[model samples]
Target: MNDFKQELIRYPAARITEVAKALSGDLRVRILETLGDMPMGVSQLAEALGVAQPTMTINIQILEQAGLVVSSPGANREKICYVTCKSILLELPVKTGDGLHRIEQIHMPIGMYSRSIVRPTCGMAGHDGVLIGSIDDPRAFYMPERTDASLLWFSGAGCLEYLFANPIPPGVPLDELRLTAELCSEAPSFDMNRQSDISLYMNDMPVGTWRSPGDFGDRKGKLTPDRWFSGTEYGALTEWKVTKDGGYVNGIRATGTTLGDLSLDYSEPIRVRLEVGKEAEFQGGLNLLGSGFGDHPQDIVMSFVRSIDRQ
Candidate 1:
């Protein structure tokens, strides 16, 4: 449907039990199948499935909790549910012959940026989707409560920088470093046709730039709060990886910049910057999503993997 956003969802083994419990019931499975075609009200689903409205509501809540369904208020205050994920990818943990930690990860919240220089159409919202300060005010970014932001947007051109504490252990010999975040373009209300060129930098070294397809608001996000009816809903998950050979975006080489160019220092914090330069061909702006406001339930994540041989 034109009014829905669907994407594959990836989960780790730790969440397998919760996801499995949600799909264990036959009725819940049928509900997902039905919603796959269209969004439906609780009463509508109940009628189609030959069940009482209360029963349907209960099942819907279960699916919603598991992030399989997202619901919003429809006419007459009725709850309308939409399927949020096209598929699910479960990643099982690998067993290491020797007991040791080979990977280190850190999650950074959106509002925790060390510096933000944004233009108009800029603002941030807390995990509950409530505005932290006056919308479109650059000074709003400096608010003390901004640290709780789950969603942030800016127009024209600007940059958001973050400083993360180095997580690599001393003399670990890193093999690869990865950074991932949910992001998209920004538009008034929402425009599927909008596009934006966004760039990323690691420790002041240029990583690469990516073109965002559009500002998606057609449907609610799985983890997005129901109270948030803002035009922007969800974003695509973008990742930047650095290896000894070069820098890549989504596994495709984007630049000759190698991991060595990053000049990562274990004794210092890591700096990350996401920006839309004034010279960008597509100046549509940018929207960044955090754990409580996107289809993916994660914030800005950085993972450092140790060398295989050393592990």
Candidate 2:
């Protein structure tokens, strides 16, 4: 229960889904319980769970990602791990003056874009993990089944736009605005060195830019399809939050543009755009990961964090 990380967490409401996903696995839960009283190595956990070392590693990674576990280099090249959360309590969204905030979230499928401008080296995949058309074809993005896309990627100057029904409470001014998505740099094939400057816009105003380090190909994505090949295996799940001060990427300050700068209002559906600026220093491409192609289990997730009892 040495959950110092969670105890002093700067943000909690925003991470509920990640924590839930981590606790969803039966085996992961067992590992966490086994490490309750003491820290152990990967091999020890595997032996205790009667699973292979690789399987244990993957499960441990998920736990680490959720911030429920911590791992450090042990003696003799072994990795020591321990539980980070003493306890977890789930609460229904409550309205009690300023003590609590409720977050409203929605997911947008990859192909539900209201506007799509992409170049060659682009295509969409459905829930079945099959490509809608040949690469370098824009028409593939318009396929009817695109609503089922579990993953999407593109290169050169490109972007996919989406609309979200306004969820801001009538009387509550937004306290924070955020967007979460799994993405990576796009390469012609599987080059791991590719990079891209991906940007996000609200109501046609730029909020911030995230510089993707590379087109990831280190290993196959946890949910990636077995048939897909010669391309990226997956990408990184990034979170961007905007407030009065500015825009933050994964909790780090990224831009000076504040939420008010985006001009979001309840009068109409919010216009959300994900794009790779052609003028960006790195125009490698864009890989918008979906449920089947990234570590996260969500599509384009947008959040409107509002004070339930704005007084």
**Pick by lDDT: which candidate is best?**
1
Alpha carbon lDDT of each predicted model: 0.87, 0.79
lDDT of 1 by residue, 190-226 (tens): 8988999998999888788889999999999888899
List the candidate 1 regions with Cα displacement exceeding 4 Å: 1-100
lDDT, candidate 2, 147-202, per-residue tens: 78887888876888999988664556777888999999888776777778998888
TM-score of 2: 0.67
- Tell me model 1's lDDT, rounded to 2 decimals: 0.87
Question: Which portions of model 2 miss their true places by more than 4 Å?
Answer: 1-101
- Quote each prediction's TM-score: 0.68, 0.67
Best by TM-score: 1
